[model samples]
Target chain A: MQPLEKTGNILPLLHEIRHALEDLLATGQTMVIDLQAMPFAPSELVELKEILGVGEVSAELHALGKSTIQETAFSGAWWIVHFNIDEKMISQTIEICHIPAILMAQHADIQMGLQQLSSTLGGVSL
Target chain B: MNQLSLEERLRLHGVSRRGFLKFCAATASLMALSPAMIPRIAAALENAKRPSVIWLSFQECTGCTESITRSHSPSLESLIFDAISLDYHHTLQVASGDAAEHAREQAMKDNWGKYILVVDGSIPLGNKGFSTIAGISNVDMLIETAKGAAAIVAVGSCAAFGGLPKANPNPTGAVSIDMIIKDKPIINVPGCPPIPVVMTGVLAHFLTFGTLPELDHLKRPKAFYGQNIHDRCYRRPFYERGQFAETFDDEGAKKGWCLFKLGCKGPTTYNACATTKWNGGVSFPIESGHGCLGCSEPNFWDAGSFYAPLSTPIGHVAQNAGYALAAGALAGAAIGFANKQKSSQAIEKHEEITVNDLIKGETK
Candidate 1:
């Protein structure tokens, strides 16, 4: 595919990300840009990722298929890509935050863990 | 699977909360919902009861069934089916003849007033003999089944809008489900065969909320059909710049220019084909360099030529579209063909060779 960069939409997106990163630093506000919602060419997506580059932290959650969460070269800006069981890209997002929400443990799961840990203890004190 | 709760089914599938959360996030994006709703969606689906679905096929090609069932493995539709009880589907159900008819009756008797009624294909009204299931007429069967249904889901253009059967010469006097079933809330999921994910999305919404999703004037889910294909089209830039592909394999075509002149119906048509896409996100029709057939809309088969510009509606497809335009209205902006003179002028400005050669190498 061609760059499809003729529209110059990439420049505005970069500016948006920069502004979002700034907002994160100043006010601790988190922003998520849903990549699928926008009309992005495949080549344009590649261009955006290359310009963002890779950062220090990267984690892959092997849950429903495989999803990767990686911080870009710019701190507080992370890229998260989700795939289905067949390993097709389903959702991709650029989140401006210290940590994306999917990484956090869910409350219900925590409660279930607590129950399991209690049963595992079985009269033994921690 | 039918007896198990969605929570139990997920437990059996070895899906964790994080995994389920990932699914919900993807679904939220698919439904055009914000990230904030992901948690709620997860909670609702995790504990959802298995709603029995009774599918009735009338005047259809069974393409809708094929589209939904033959979906890629571990898809949302597959998961939804695992969670719900598909009590009857004439095409998919193993039982046939009297056994199949009995199953439908038994399911209706069991879940009456609560089960979902999914109707595919148009309903013939010309004569009772035109279409029948076990000697029962289409209208009679629809009216009988709809009476007990909590809600009716009109799947495919046939069931939703009388499809091809009700075209210019509508032989069987075919009519859509909504035209007959008035007492029930009908959700129309239209397409020659709607994108599989969309049909599942509507089902998921109903399962999660215990109610139908917000619908458009056409009764299609607003989230999926709200945006115009042209607005979200990748070649929209070409249209804005007044560059167009006058022919299929011309210089402009190779350059990925706008297809408006080649008769794209993106401007007026509404559907999720552009964003949600089809065939597991491979590509949509426009991306493959064909005009939108507007198959999801009422009387789409009768719409102007798939090759004629949307503005000029005098071709084979246009005659059908003209009537709908009078009643349905809006043929979009009257783009002047005067821009044909500018095509050659823009060619001189292009200098870069595309990466098609590399793609050709990869194919080899």
Candidate 2:
């Protein structure tokens, strides 16, 4: 199949996403762009990223294996990549929001950290 | 009576202010309100007095109540519903017999011209014996209850468009709420059982703005029913490219092509099922492999068979074809003769080229 036709024409989908992203930005709402729903070759994925460009903010999440998050040039848009235990690609998506939810520490995890810190401080001098 | 404010009730439910704000933001987005309106929505819902709601059930299957109550346990939608002063709901309230009738009367009297009147099912005007609440006929009860309403909400297809109870016969003479209540502002949220969030969303809008949200010609909220199902369908690309599934188990069906040829009524039907989805945004009928029944529209029962393709003429297939056939024959013969003469001339003028002529190109 031609490289253009291999992806089953995601340009229309991209147009829709762009419009939705604009609406999300305007409304302060978060939206998830599910890449799994579309058939995009590696080259097409790279092309999509290039078209969207990249911003300055990026983060690495180390909880359940390693996941990388990158922000696009668009004000509130982001790209997140998750990997399996074997470092194989698990899932990828373009998330539009003021900040992606993956980087935030859960309340339970924060409580655990607080408990550990207070117990250690109680034993130590300072 | 539940006297606590919405914010106080939410706090009692263990929902934080931030969580409540998030719910407000989500509600605003769903209603297509601006982000600037988020804070306003939060403020309104927070301190808003719980409006009394009198739910009247007539000729319904209890599906609308079921749909609105299908939210998760301790869900924001459920909490919002809990925040409302639902004074009388025959299906959910514990009162029975004369007590239920008294409760409805007391609610309407207490909150005269202030409470929201929610009606489900169609009103039968054929005979007073057709349907009744206590001893009052459905039509009489509706007319009496709707008199002092701030606004009437017609939930489900029955209340909005005289559904199955009013199908094709003249027996019951069932009619919608809008057909009877001409003085009051009626907001129709028509669906087989409307999306739960939509019901709550409309309530939120009214609570926030103190007025009904924008509605379409059918009195359905345009925010939820603005776009046609086909336009928002996931398999729309297949329709645009002329790919369709002829049968249930065909290759096109297996490949998840469009269901238009399989009697999908998505093109004309307008609803939010395709976008908002059903059962907690899981999947709608088309996604689960079935044609739309056009349940939200008026007189959908008489629309046609659910399995007949939209291209197929509904009532007079053979008669319409017979009429078209005679006209087509005359036009076909003339076109066929003209085509024969044109093709013969083209063939006579045709020239053959050798392999060397391919190198010579078109100029030669």
Candidate 3:
């Protein structure tokens, strides 16, 4: 396995990962992404699992140099990804793999419309 | 001689013809008897023979006396003095000092073991010095007078359960008449100031039957205190619909919703106030928008704050709480299943049991 350098531009990486998973789903292959090495929120993990139709993702904390990749089959194809990074590298990786800007921009527009409707109708503002 | 009609008997007894008729009308109304019972009441009253009486005033405020005096129909003058030979009443008798005490002794001597004793207060036992009427301790006076009486009528909350005087500290050590006079039959007509008609009604019942009316465990006449006020309350429909007045002058209050939430004690109080009412059947406290203070119940003053709600639980675990919801759910399910089963059975039994046959079977 080759080590992928963790980068500060995390959103681009996350968008690419989501697109890759969506393509893999269209090809009728199930995918499971192990987030054991990543410092991420459980709620975001749950949302990611729901979006990808993955079976399960296990999380654990351990010392450096002991990290390993466990391969599993999905619709007759085997795939795995593993990495070991310092705290700074982890933060840079998160920044690079955060949610996409286009989806955020769309969400902002929807929220703005909701706020206007609430103000006009005297209901809860978004 | 059986020679006098009711009108003639009244005349012979010094009750004028008009007074006798008026008494009959008042008796009929008080007893909730039909107007037609006037003649029967008249006959009963005419033959009553002025049952011997011994009136005792113990540790009381004399409010019961004040209340009976305000009766407009027959009036106190006619009811006490003429209707029955009031042998001894400290307030009403003209005699005073030793003369009054001698009269009481003479009346007891004349009608030994044959007079009705009317007690209007509690007995104080904290010390002999707590209460004394005419230089005699009330405890001694009550016990001495009660021994020779035929029956006893405790005529207010004071005499029934020591009333307000017995609340909390109860420094006087006040106790009801029932606590002292344990031998003879006792009837309690309890209220802050008992309704006048109820007092007279019990007297009339005793006169007519020659025995006490039916009584509850509290020794109150069951005819009057038999049912809880809630059972007969006019605002019960609003309670059934879950409507309640949250405050005294809210829209719900004006609309006459149940006063349960506003500290109404009617639900737990047993009395005839809701039905018999007060002030000549004009209106009771609840009718006037004030919650029931439950003045008739024993230890009413100490039964917690008068304006506090019943403190009953109001959810599924409450005695009858969630009953409507449970019943409706079960009934709806049962009806739907029964209908489905009936339709399926109808198809199977179509030829044998026609609709006419089913109707005939139902009738049979």
Say which candidate scores most in lDDT: 1
Report how closely model 2 matches the true complex, as a DockQ value.
Answer: 0.04
Instruction: List the pairs of residues colliding in candidate 1.
Output: B303-B317, B304-B317, B304-B318, B305-B317
Error of 2 at B23 (Å): 1.8
Tell me which residue pairs clash in candidate 3: A9-A96, A10-A95, A10-A96, A10-A97, A11-A96
Total clashing pairs in model 2: 0
DockQ scores for all the models shown?
0.33, 0.04, 0.00
Model 2 docking tier (incorrect/acceptable/medium/high): incorrect
lDDT of 3 by residue, B220-277 (tens): 9987888788777766667787988899989788776778888888887888777677
Off by over 4 Å in 1: A1-9, A110-126, B1-5, B315-364
Query: If ranked by TM-score, best first, what sequence of candidates would result?
Result: 1, 2, 3
> So what's the TM-score on candidate 1?
0.85
Reference-based lDDT, each prediction = 0.86, 0.78, 0.66
Residue B201 of model 3 has an lDDT of 77
Off by over 4 Å in 2: A1-126, B1-4, B32-36, B319-364
Model 3 misplaced regions, further than 4 Å: A1-126, B1-9, B12-26, B32-43, B72-81, B312-364
